[model samples]
Target: MRSLVLIGHGSHLNGESAGAVYRYAELIRERGLYDEVVEGYWKEEPSLRQVLKTTRSTDVTVIPMFISEGYFTETVIPRELGLGHQGPVPGEGIARVLGGRTVRYTLPYGVHPSMSEVILARAHEALPDLNPGDTALIVLGHGTTRNENSNRVIYQNADRLRESGHFAEVHALFLDEDPRVGTWPEVVRSPRVVVVPFFASEGWHTLETIPEDMGLTGEVTVFEDHPSGSQTVYYARPVGTHALVAEVVLHLAEEARGASERGGDEDRTHAEAWHAFMALAQEGVRLGEALITPHGSLYEIRHALDEGRPSDALTTVVTPEGLRDLTRQDEGGRHRPVHTFRNLPRGWRAVLSVTDLPQGVHNLYPAVVEEGYAHHCHSLRATPWPTTARRQTGIYAKVSRATPEQVEAVAKDVCSRCLKTRLWAGEKLPRTFFTRVPGAIPCPEACTYFIAEAREEVSGKRSQGGHDHG
Candidate 1:
């Protein structure tokens, strides 16, 4: 059976981010849809690269468990896995593979047809008394200045729902551009309208801004004197936790399977192999490290070549000629590096500690590892990484040798790096509950505690703009 990989845009700070993906992976695994199912994240452990190493199925299908078909779906995941539609070399269309490993990539979770069910479910929950001519539904999404495609998906969902004739009106509003959610009152003529968030998780904007801006109370409420004196506004929960999301993953997997099967006649270009080699090298680049000349790098290179992106190989090099010269110099290399990288394949497993908190890993963990994946007890656990680390109440990663306290420090370090990036960019998220003094040196010593506490505080402060996950 094929291995199914679920990739999430995880958070080092918010443990729930990873929890959601794992939950879905487990659910799917329980149904026996795939022989092997695993979870990986862009930010957290058992990363996309490493998670790939843990699976041994001849065929692999990757589903991007993101909320939208934006950057992470379009750029980041593809960049990481070396999959996309491109011809080989200058003349022929070649089938390129990743490090000689053949895998198919499906569209993200957000763009799947199954999402319509969640939207309809949210709308129904928002307006139970709805009958046709009375209540309207407004889907709100956090449109980005960076990617217009994000809003496009939201609008498309709106259109699909609108065409279904479920509500008197179904429209979409964005946080960034025109037809904004804050200005939604101007466009609506309905007496009562349900506002549903089109976000992945109940993060800052959905929990705070839209409701505050729309003059809502509780998760669902109505307001008068907002649009017209008769108009009532109700806010609904985010569409992330719905059961229909699984269908979305299946749909994406099918698409990837089709594409991979149809592209067999393509040429064999070493571009993918070259690209993978460069990616591995770049990981070590920050430490001023370089990859071994021939065999050590060949596996990733071959994978890339099979996937059909020779140009990526060319770009991975500091100089294209340098990479070409290296490949030519060692054209007769052996597969010892491949043997070193390949290991015993392991299925997805977790030992979660549950709690009452809604946002922490503790709550999300049980759900993520529920049905599809395996649960490991302390003694039978595959690695001690889950036990040794200083774990936040809701988070886990594979750090075998480290103590729990050491893992806690690593978590804090990830948060600190992200915080530094935010500061350097002079950027502000849509909903921020607390702000540090400008140029304040963040104390890294208590970083994990601060991150968990800061997010908890932010989630509780809905009036200030952060989402209330609780």
Candidate 2:
């Protein structure tokens, strides 16, 4: 039978993300709609790669457990699964994916019509003791300044909820971007506020962040003596995790099964990948360093290649041909590096890697396959380089965090990124990649980074940015 795989953005910080995905998957599986129903996650196990391998079904459907057709749905998922070279299409699409599987990729959850009832049901469940007319409703979302599309359904649904005339006021707030949730107290006119979190799960945002951001004393709490009066914010569970979402997943899967194919024949290019790249560019993710071959170096390297001479200054070149190609295209304008290295969403993602993230193995300096792709994680993980004194080449790194305590936090964040990326690149993630900094006192050439014992405080422009990335 055709298997169904539910993809979720699980949390490295909390297990609730995986729990919610499993809950939804179990609910769907109990119906026995498919031969197998398995779940996959980005941040936690069983990873998307592991799930793919575990499922022996030749025919399958992968539904993104996201609210909208945003970055995860568009870029990351497609890249990981090797489905859409172009990027995510709206709603659903049929793609001849890897492993020769006829995978039907579904749109995120929020677009389904059944979701409106799900949200309303959640509100009704949360407001058993209060009156809907006296209570204001807030659709809290994790909005993004990077991609405006992330919250389009949120505001649209908020308007729909307001039109229902069941609440005193209906407003939308986001944790990331404007309409900041903090400003709700000033505009909220009701004594009771029911917050239906528009998150994928009860991960960081729903359980920890939204509650902390709202300054609630408990999950369901009463804040006495606000300017508006004593207000009780009823923090409802995430709509995505609500049992009704199982139906939504089935709805999307059925839609995917019914729809005809809409992807291109093997070689067609797409603007969606570029759009996702540009969207990410606006999001302010800094690279620890870009392993960019400068125009002069690029030219020198090309000349060397022509003359059969190896680059002296270049330690580990990404590729011999792509560097030459980039150098050939430099026409005086700022030459953006085709790729970069960082401790990020995963490891070593290209600055514009619309194709993949948790990109390969982490590189000390940047190297690339130009507009093409190249990452070395699988080989690296399977047969790791021995960090021997013979290849000892140490270099210091400056972490952005202020204190050693914060330094450890940032270090662990980077470690999490490595593990996250490794899952995508190497197909299996180590439970823990590192504790403090990776490398030893006598570092090796293939070692990702080398920092001595005790993180020396980075007190420069790099330190200016907040440690939230950690």
Candidate 3:
């Protein structure tokens, strides 16, 4: 069996940071090229450290959905995946034999030559009517002084566009380093310019910071009384969000798969756990915010609140990806990372085949089936609050100084907002009243958001020169 794992840098502040990664994973899964396709993140659940354990496939291909071959792609990800200290070299790729499986790591998609095509396509899509010869193209990247490779891809793409002679001028701009986005007016000579962000996902930087720095108000911003004369600017979405990028990932995965030897057997334990969960689902089980019930050969999954509603009454989602997208946001249109939040909207139901049931459940509530199976087997490794706090580093390291009372208070507050039962807190704290569901999902460890909140509480108390004894 073979698996494909896409890794990205998820954010605690913005759930959409990993949106593109999830979308690509689903797209690839629909193609049915691999036995399994999953996503791992640095700052989100089903994290990099534990993503491998969930996959039953023996031969796995890991791809980084990052914009550059820098710190994250080169250092952090490899270390987290136990691949070694250095990342895979571009084009050649790298492979390692670990834990009875052959894991192949590939160069990030951003460094691929195909990215230049994605950038050009984005530029043309943003301003189709405008003539490329009269419009200047700007590839905006979040460059850093720490990693020179981070800036290389941007320059390479700009040079490629220049060689193609599609645009009157191609300029590369950065958010942090020299030739910043603010200097766009002075850098470009064309009267019309299109700026395309070279980042992976549209999060804080693309949505807020880049627009603010570039004096852009909307898709088309016109400057009448500017220092460099009147010019019309068109802003394109991030290049990584383009649909064609999925094809690039597939190309990389195929190349790596051809080069590596696949021999290890499937993870029988994971298969057994999935089978056990399926057996429970056959008798109707409530997992997280979903109420899954078997209807003949198909499983009908709906919000736990809509248990009694007839199938015709609720909106039916035909595809698994459709249901995943439907629940990606809340009623207010904000991204909800905690999929098990009680507010799973209303009047939406999904009918999935027996084969697709596991993917459907995972899309709605990630990693729940595995956790449930582990809990049933008495093998769930629930990390306590103290151990979780001690694992923190950098600014979050101060979380260790928080009093037990403060930790308890924060856990109660945060867990109340989420539907997952806090298995991490162990027997020290009583279970939240709402999370007493018999087959509810389990949280094996404190999430990054919980750690952030704990750090804030500890910092606030220290600032006020007060401590809570209780």
The regions of model 1 sitting more than 4 angstroms off are 84-96, 259-470
Residue-by-residue lDDT tens digits, candidate 3, 1-470? 88889998876546667778988987888788888888888777567766776778778889989878976777767866778757447576788876666788888988888899999899989999767668999999999997888899999999999899888899999999998999987778788999999988777899999999998999999999767678999999999899989888988887773454453578776788788878778888777667788989999988888889887898898677778878877877766655665667777899999988888877787776676677666677888878878756556789999898887778666677787778777643233212335435667877766776788788774223222221
lDDT of each: 0.50, 0.53, 0.79
- Positional deviation of 8 in candidate 1, in angstroms? 0.8
State the lDDT of candidate 2 residue by residue for 1-470, as single tens digits. Answer: 57788888765333334567667766887798776676666544344434454443556788888888777777767755667544557555655666555677877877676777787888888887656668898898898887778878888888887887877889989999889998888889899888888876656677688888889766578988789679888878888778888888888887884433332122111122223323433343222322222232121112212222344533333433223223312234222121121221111111223222211211211221111111111222121222121222222323322354644443454433331232211233221111111110110111122122112234332232222110
**Candidate maximizing TM-score:** 3
Ranking by TM-score: 3, 1, 2
Candidate 3's C-alpha runs over 4 A off are 11-15, 74-76, 79-99, 127-135, 165-168, 190-192, 203-234, 255-264, 328-335, 340-346, 384-387, 416-423, 428-437, 440-442, 461-470
In candidate 3, where is summed lDDT lowest over 10 consecutive residues? 461-470
Name the better of 2 and 3 by lDDT: 3
Best by lDDT: 3
What lDDT score is found at residue 458 in candidate 1?
30
Candidate 1 steric clashes: 36
Q: Tell me, what's the RMSD of every candidate?
A: 20.3, 19.1, 5.1
What lDDT would candidate 1 get against the real structure? 0.50
Tens-digit lDDT track of model 1 for 19-68 = 57766876787787676577766655444434554454545777778787
